[model samples]
Target: ARRRLYPKPFPGIPYNKVSANRIAGDLPELIPVIKATNEYSTSMFAISTQRLRLPLAQDPREIEDILVRRGREFDRAPMSIKTLKNFFPYSFMGKYNTPEVKEQKRIWADAFGADFLRKVAAPSIYNATLDLADGRPFEVVEDLHNATLDAIWVALVGEEAGITRHEIKKFLQSQRDASDGGRRDPGPPPRGYLLRREVDYVSEMIAKNSSSGIPVLAQKLAAYLPRHRQFRRTVDTEIGLVMRKAVDRFQRLELGRLEAGENDTCMMDLVLRRKVLEAKKLGRPLMDPTKDKVLLDDTFLMMFASYPTAQTELRAALKVAFPHPTTPSVDELLGADIPYLDAACEESLRLAGVAKGNLRQTVVDTHIMGHFVPKGAEIFMNYHVDHAPYPVDEEKRSASSQAAGAKLAAREGISRGDVSRDLGSFEPRRWLVKDEKTGQEVFDAYALPQLAFGGGYRGCSGRKLAVMEFRTVVALLVLNLEFLELPEEMKTLKASETIFRLPDMPFASLRAL
Candidate 1:
């Protein structure tokens, strides 16, 4: 009767037999794993009776099948949608492949288009990075995070956020105020420095939200906790700031006060301008920015999601690319021929491993890595472990995937196993290939199994924008400054995950080139 009353693992799949007997199933075992890794790292352990689990996919070929080819078999996990919807209701992050999501994507499609990225986003990112070349031994992670915030803010609102600039000004002031003529490295700025209250609040809330796997329950319980209550209040205040910026852009469009060229408008102006055009075409009234929940929600989501990944990956890229601080001009760094820099960035992205994996739900009963997944079962494509040197159980993979894997293995520079031994190290040359037409080596994205930005329709929509921002920041910094070698105590690679994976020790001792 208990077997029927409580959930149990599907028949013929691997599971903890002892967990099946308990009402909590895998909760007892799962907590420890989450505590250690900030993620579910129980590869192939399907002990979660709440849902049939395929913990992590060790094979990249099968990952491609699940994310791309077999879309009918797997899709965005329902639990993921449920959890994220509370925070990002109108954003694509929380939605399935429906008409609404398609429309949302279409409306904002040009935001990341090549022309917009080059003319609008790139300049904004370049301007933001200008404040960082002061040659102080600043906290690399925090400063970069602020720089990203500034860049994204300018892209979204068509004005300077001055976040990084403000921090720099404060840092300079702090140094000047010191009795010893500011010669000492005072380390990263104190918490709540100037406009960082909102940033800290967002981080605190996300960390608290993810700490308990059950976000919805945790959200409800948050109302009673004093710290959480403050976080909610601050987040709400931040939302007001975002909404007001939208309102300002909307009013400017309505009043024909666009100071920049039509093509150079901020992301908010682009959306509002399109909306105005659409309303005029349909003979409807102009939509209010305050009333359009989709507009407000997606803008908020973009601000929160854009920065952390680039900052983390940039740290990894810098560590790999510039060991002795040889500088290049900005033109050389951003030119088409910098294959080494490009390769280093790709390698760092692979090593950063911000997300543990992406979750997918089975649309119908299907096979993954030769195991039977029941309809509605959830599976995690464990890119984090797959990028590592985990042994692939080839016999367990489906025949079609096996054929695909075999075909990839036959090609030189295609198979991941070719460089399996060096997977853990930072080697950029692995991603470089001699271009037959140009007779010059170039970074080949396909050289490695690419899952950093994810794949298919449900993949990260802002990937292009993120990459552009990352490359621009990395190039500017690498060209203009020399990142000095850190002391042993400051070289720790420990990271903490919340909204995104972030380095715990993100300092960069530097000198002006």
Candidate 2:
């Protein structure tokens, strides 16, 4: 049994010999530790201990095989989102592979489908960017989040809803309350804060109940923790408000459409109308519209995931956007001829590494990459590890060749040292190149195209909407704004790792066009 369960750890110190925490605190480069200990191992490894097994599908082929080919054989780690239930006793995030989840996913996918999203959001996004032409330096993250919040909320949530009018302060404050065990004061949130419902909704869900032991079990026990008590209040209050507002607006829209014989669809209206139909057939009173569970829950899930991922990608794009050589004008960027801008978006997501990986579970005992993974074991499908760019071919990087080049340069009166381009650097041009002969646009696909958005059947449902929003918003901002490099002092910004990689407190500023 021990042999079957452990399958020999991937050549690392025994769990008892060294601690994961100590290694994190004491070691500056844990990647070196991984390289040394798990040197040649691939696919799966216990790394530290039998109880701490981590399956790494590092190769793109293996990633495709697992996440795409054999995706059904696995499920997202069951406990990965169990903590979400504290907010909605039945958060669809905590449940998976059910008919309800499927139904909700279908609805969400349709609502965020490319056509539906663009029709609703294109004009607003264009106008939002144009609004930023004041030339004063403003916080880019804050502005982006606010604009993203409004765009999504108005399009998906309600026609009248706007980000500035939403209780943005409450959500941000609530998130702080939830994560820190209510250690911070439960102070009153400011009114009319920007980035309201969308921000708070996701933030509260993000707060993990404190624990040091096995994460799955620790999270399971997190809700009963005292800190969650305060956080729950924030969640309950906001859920009530969002649900009330969504339902109220949905009814009015449906009534108007029916009366005027018009065919219009807002996101929530579809779900509500479906519920009403189900109720009429089943002889029940539309069964607590919000209690359909998946409808509201899934909206929250998509919004929660969508907004932050958009923020990360947008912020990353801002870092590379122009007041410089790579800049394009509004017409040029929007004209569909800008391959470099498109490549820049892709590269930004890859480098941001926002979602490092997903945690999946082996549904039954299975064999992968020659390792025996038993039923219920966890698999860490790491995007960061699998998305690595390969080292430069040594033959092309020979020391003799480099020395000769240096000598040639010296003789030419430009004594520059051998320039080694870091393959791992953020090079947007990796995605495209100008054709040498015809100068036509051509794709120079990354050697290993980044799967920052997980690749598989369970690929992001919100991806279409996210793409549209990111492309439109980032491009508009880039066309008009400039992101200044941070001062050395401000550069001290630390990243707070979560399900997403978030800047702890980024102070990036943007100037108007």
RMSD of each: 5.4, 10.9
Compared with the true structure, what per-residue lDDT tens digits does model 1 show for residues 1-513? 766655467666566676677776656777776677654433222234233334455566677667766776777987678666755667787888788888988878887777776767776776777676655556777777788878887787676777776677677777677856656455565322422555555556656665565666775565467865564455445555655665554544532433233644577767766676666557788766656778766776777767565333444455455544554333434444556667777777777766656789888988776667789887767565233544668887766667767876666532232544457667767777776566666677767676776677777777888877777766767656667778999876566666566777777877766
What does candidate 2's lDDT look like per residue over 1-513, in tens digits? 433533333333233323233423212333344344322121123232232444454444355456655766777676565655644555555665677666656655656666655554455544444444334454556656666666665555545334332334445566788888675443543322323643564464353321233444556565577665655454445444666655555455444354332233355555555555455556676556545555555655655666665333444444454436544444444445445666677776766666666667888877665556678776666565323433433334324334543544444212222222453466665666556566565444333435677766577766666666667666766555667666777764234444465665668666554
Residue 432 lDDT in candidate 1: 76
lDDT of 1 at 114: 70
lDDT (Cα atoms) of all candidates against the true structure = 0.65, 0.52
The ten-residue window of minimal lDDT in model 1 covers 42-51
Off by over 4 Å in 2: 1-51, 124-134, 159-211, 225-266, 277-284, 310-337, 385-423, 433-439, 442-447, 485-494
- Candidate 2 Cα deviation (angstroms), residue 6: 10
